[model samples]
Target: MIEIACDESGADGENLVGGNTLFFAHGSVDVSVEFAGSVISEIRERIRSPAEEYKANHLLREKHRAVLEWLLGALRGRAHVELVRKESFLVGRVVEVLGGEGAPSGEGVPEEVWGAFVRAGNRLLRVRAEVDSGVLVEEFFGSLDALRSAVAGTEAGEMLARLSGRRERAFAYRASIPTLIPVLDPLFPTIVDTAAHWSSPGTPVHLVHDRQTLLTPARVEWIRQRAEARGVTLAGLRLVQARSDPRVQLADFLAGIARKIAGDEATGVGDPVLGELLRPYLEAGALRGDGARKG
Candidate 1:
């Protein structure tokens, strides 16, 4: 079975909001251990930084620009990065949970108007008046509530009126279900995507990831099941410390740099050249900035 080494940066679990980082980036490398070790040794020789274990920050500096460029170009073919915006995810969940499956059609209002309101609802959640995640979730629900007036006398209004009662119940149920909370964690989706990417045909892939508290045995099984459902074969998942595995450390470097690049792009401050270099590896389907879609 082929093996893929993986790591992540800015991982805040499900606590995307009120978390330390603005973006999460997951990286997977399909390189051999020997290749990873050689890359690390080359960097140690080039930068000559006294740090025992090298990190992304070490190469991100202006002085190391040349090495960073060399590193990105070298791993272009084998490394892939997945980027996600936390708040935008919540806005999407708002639409999925409360917006219902099928689109609404009625004499109450035109379908076009309904579409506008849906977009508006997403915008409402994207605009954060509060920093507290709990309050942010409440505000998301409240944004739905406040829209009652905005969508009044329209088909969208009727739909919101119906979902009004379910919001509180949804919140209450989520609180009671402990397992549901972990499932919301972004790491799970990133893992599933990495597994799916490497799982070729009938050949299952054994995924080696950096040690993370969230990668419990049960969760690893869930990742396998999820991968299978998506037509990907996962042999199994194994966790190792970054120090013990050079491959995992390399994955960390890619992830760390990717996260920084994504964050810079979100805020409109970054080296344009470097951002373009990492662009090809960044997942095309992840939500962009705080609320826009990317491809």
Candidate 2:
């Protein structure tokens, strides 16, 4: 069996609607601790930062361009990342709610249906932090009437019209679970994909993640169950302090860097060369929003 170290950036738990970051990146790496430590050491030699933890920002500086490219080249095939466009994810949840899917968890709709939902949601949604969940829900539903016009005559528009015929249903759904906004945490899918990526039918993989509050005991078990159902051996999953594990720190660097670049792309300010370097490490169904998915 193999062991993979993992970490995530831009995770706001269930606060997908209004969060601090535009993208949530879940990163996993197969490199050994010694190798990861060497990577960290190499960065220190070049950048010479005073921070105890060498994060993605250290490598993202203008003066550290060569250092960042070198690190990406060194980690080329050893790393994997799954990115979520936060606002688009919220749009998917809106579909689940309006489609009468009951709850927004795993694959709430068919592939075609999910695609339609994303297109419709993309037209109306904006990435901004809401003051509270109530405001978030209210503002989302308020935009529905106009969204119909935005995606008029399209398949996504028809789907939204049929599902959201009565806007009251959306609010009622929210009222049922006052605290939970039919949340779908992207980390679950990311972990499952990461497990399948590193492990084959016979070869299991143990995942070590940087500790996250969202990963409760029940949630960890849920991830394992999902992985097993997908025919992957998630033999074990553990949480560790990133400070103690160089492998996890390596994951941190990858996740943070990926999030930054992807965020830039979503905002229309990305560098084409850097995007090319990060393209290979992305997982499936990434950057879903507006009209299509981004690689």
Candidate 3:
């Protein structure tokens, strides 16, 4: 059986607005628990001692960087990691578009529009134009029709016609998950499914999430139902404070590293050492960024 401990960072108001990191581990429960304690102890010691190069404002300071590098190195192949980040403005735009409100003007384009554009071919250029111009929905659809008529005999027109049949129910339903869960929807299932796949067949899975206001009983039930439908047996699902569980603390640091990287990306900065630390998981296809999908 594989035990998974989960935590998140940047979900709270932070450097990267709307940015979040969902990190979890799948491995031997006892071993992970033990290692978590050791990692916590190491971090505490490093915090007590000062390192000259580790400035106060640095997101990935030297001591924190050292601890993360060590933790990630130790977990390299033993545990799987996944990351999902969304630009808040982009997410808000997506919510607005799908929710069918134009009252609030926004700068970013919705993910569905991009998906529709890709699937609908060049005729959808008018839709893109309308969006870029911040046109109202009615005007945008009118432009779409006009473009369709102009390209009626071409291949692009046929693709544009196909876009009309795309099912948007799934995208709309995701909006109901509430709070940060909507942002986390894409990552949760992928990580759970991946962990299930890696575990021995028929072994029961236990999931422990770091406490969050959004993770209410109803939400847990919703997750359970979704997992059941997917054929993944979740033997248990519960929320606990990180301070009460060592494994959860490990998950916190893991998520923190990913969040710092994302914060760096948003601000157009780079940390080579941090990037190097995450390289193995990225190369192994364990850590993934689901930026294009709206949660």
Candidate 4:
């Protein structure tokens, strides 16, 4: 049996956006070239559409299963794939473990808490992966670095940052590939005990700049209405709504709206009304700047 624990860290907010990170450690069993190839293939097929792809399962589930199955197709064997994801603080701690301290912490602590057992489980996987000295793990961390760089200024950064800081806000995992090992050993309790103490207090996702004021309510409303008609949610409409400027770049505005919407969903309020409410300053550049009537 191989245990894999994956984690992501980042922030999601209107301003002060950062990026998200995903880290997972797998048992020595699946740390093979064949398994890595299969997992990559499955993930590529899965992420074809961002709209459809969700972080519902652990990173090493079926996506990694394809490789194992392909390699052991002929023989009748059994292996249990246990996968878990811990984002935000737990992710931060794991990264601290991998890269050392001084990694940036995310904002907002999750309401829930992660005990030592879970931490131990996570670390055990990491230890196994490191001991194996698999080049794939090195590559995985490399890609994570690139992802962080790509979303530095945008909403992507916010979402990434949000996930990195919270302990309870992680995605789900599933042990998709099942194999029969005569004797599967449980991880030592001491490993879990060691990691149980990791914790980072919740911090607010505050904007670096002053909060933008709501200006042209009417024009913002009109654009929001149009955005809604085009299948954009009301909250999404608000992130880019600017009452005074009707000629704003639709693409940039939409991009901002999309990022806010992503975080909004994670925030648990998917209502369109919220977006409509913020329409007045969507294009004003500064929320508190003068409206069309002012200048």
Candidate 5:
């Protein structure tokens, strides 16, 4: 049996950059159990602060980067991380630029152009703030119209049209899930599938997630049913406080790190240290969506 400890970060309204992490250990002879404790201790000592403090601050500091790097190195092959992030603001910007409610009006957009639009949108959002919602909305849409007209018949316009379809699908899926579990609804099944992929044939997996009020008994049952339908052998699923479990603490750290990295990426910032630590797993395609998960 394998024990998976899961946790998520970035649920606050401003930072939609969030994801879940799974810290895996074989039920028998798992070395991660001990390694987690040592890593936690080392992290605590390095930061001169409690684990909870690091989590609360979103672990974005250069000082904390090394500890996070160490943690990632330790869990390199043992954990699976998954992140689901949506830049609604950027989506909105794209909608504005293309003269549509969502997506561009033309054909298809190249990935590079889409990326540039997102980055430019991020910069714009960052620089202009503290404005009335009504005014902001008006300005945003107006800007979109201006951009659409200016770029009409240009390469950028064509690229925006191409990118619209994909963005529309993402927005559709984002709208379907309950707002409360926007991150978890899609995440739960993906994690279960990941566990099944890593487990021995016919082995039952037990899941333990950091306690959340939203993950009621009914929700757990729903996840179990879905996993069962998918032929994933789920022996049990329960919620526990991270304080009582070192593995859960590691999960929390992983989730927090993933969120910060995602937020940085959306804003066009880079953290070389964190990037290097994650390079191996990323190259192996271990991360799902914006989060990290075992492949």
Candidate 6:
């Protein structure tokens, strides 16, 4: 028998970080598990058609539909398909905290965070399911620890702690079963959000400082120029803004560096080439440089 575990992921922010993630797994000891490949193929076809822009949310559902349809069509004549997932109730606190008021939520958090959780939950389910299906799943077992790491949210940690003991039961399986399991990546929305948040104002300046300390010398010179151009006295503004718009920041930063280099050749820091490069960023209201643009 073969076992499968699945997971998925999506973007998280305007900067485009962790967004959507999903995961699940299945296993069976039937050495001649006949329908798995066909089921995966069918799922691939359905998802790819309609030429729709594929988002992270569609994958797991597609897998489910694929498995169910294939089972009913080809294998119903032989094996009784039995599949199981742990029915984890979002605890009252989890629902209250992670989920919002009234209709419920994990809404405020980035979708990728929830995606990681789903991946972890599904991976655990896969281990249990394999045992129930009497399958020896030797591959990818080490991945379970990674799943746990992904889903362990700092903000939601307490709520998750509450879920440890409640109704964490595994399902039983029977003979002649043909199952297809879809697995996906556990998302890292927190990583993206953390980046965005750290770049925002009123955040610790040291965060940016720490990042700046790690930049290459060329990038460092680039930042110095950009900051001088903007007359920005505040620490970390250049780096934070640059992280958001690398291209624009790089151009302006380079312009600033050029002006400085020219200063060594002449008297004061002024150069037509520098002005030309910085003008667009200034006009777009995206950057502020040291001196007003000169003709």
lDDT for predicted candidate 4 compared with the true structure: 0.28
TM-score of 4: 0.19
Model 2: per-residue Cα lDDT over 8-54, one tens digit each: 98887666643578888888999989999999889899999899888
Overall local distance difference test of candidate 5: 0.52
- Model 3 C-alpha lDDT per residue in residues 168-258, reported as the tens digit of each score: 5223333232453443234444445544543455876777777767666766666666666667777776778878887776666666666
The 10 consecutive residues of candidate 6 with the worst lDDT sum are: 21-30
Candidate 6 lDDT tens digits, 1-295: 1111111112111111122211111111111223444443454576664632322234324354443333334432222111111111211212232222221124454565544444434433331343533232111122322333444665444444443333212112123221221111111211122223223344322112112332445544444444334432223322333223222222222222322322322334444443343233222221222121110
Query: Which stretches in model 2 have alpha-carbon errors above 4 Å?
Result: 100-142, 166-182, 284-295
Off by over 4 Å in 3: 12-30, 49-59, 87-198, 263-268, 282-295
Count of steric clashes across candidates, in order:
0, 0, 0, 39, 14, 26
The best candidate in terms of TM-score: 2
For candidate 4, write residues 1-118 as lDDT tens digits: 1221111112121111122412111111213335434444464464443533223232224454343233223111211111112233334344433433333323332222222222
**lDDT of model number 1:** 0.72
Q: How many clashing pairs does model 3 include? A: 0
Q: Each candidate: what lDDT?
A: 0.72, 0.72, 0.48, 0.28, 0.52, 0.28
What local lDDT does model 1 show for residue 65? 91
TM, every model: 0.78, 0.80, 0.58, 0.19, 0.58, 0.17
Better of 5 and 6 by TM-score: 5
Put down candidate 5 lDDT per residue, 139-224, tens digits, no spaces.
Answer: 44344444555567876556544544444343343234244333323344445554564566677778777787767777677667
lDDT of 1 by residue, 1-295 (tens): 8899999999765555556777878888999999999999998999999898899999999899999999999899898877777655544555455545323322354555434444443433342323444554555456556666566877766777777666555555344534723433578877888877677787888989999887888888888888888988898888999999889998999999988877777667877898888877765544245322221
**Model 5 worst lDDT run, 10 consecutive residues:** 21-30
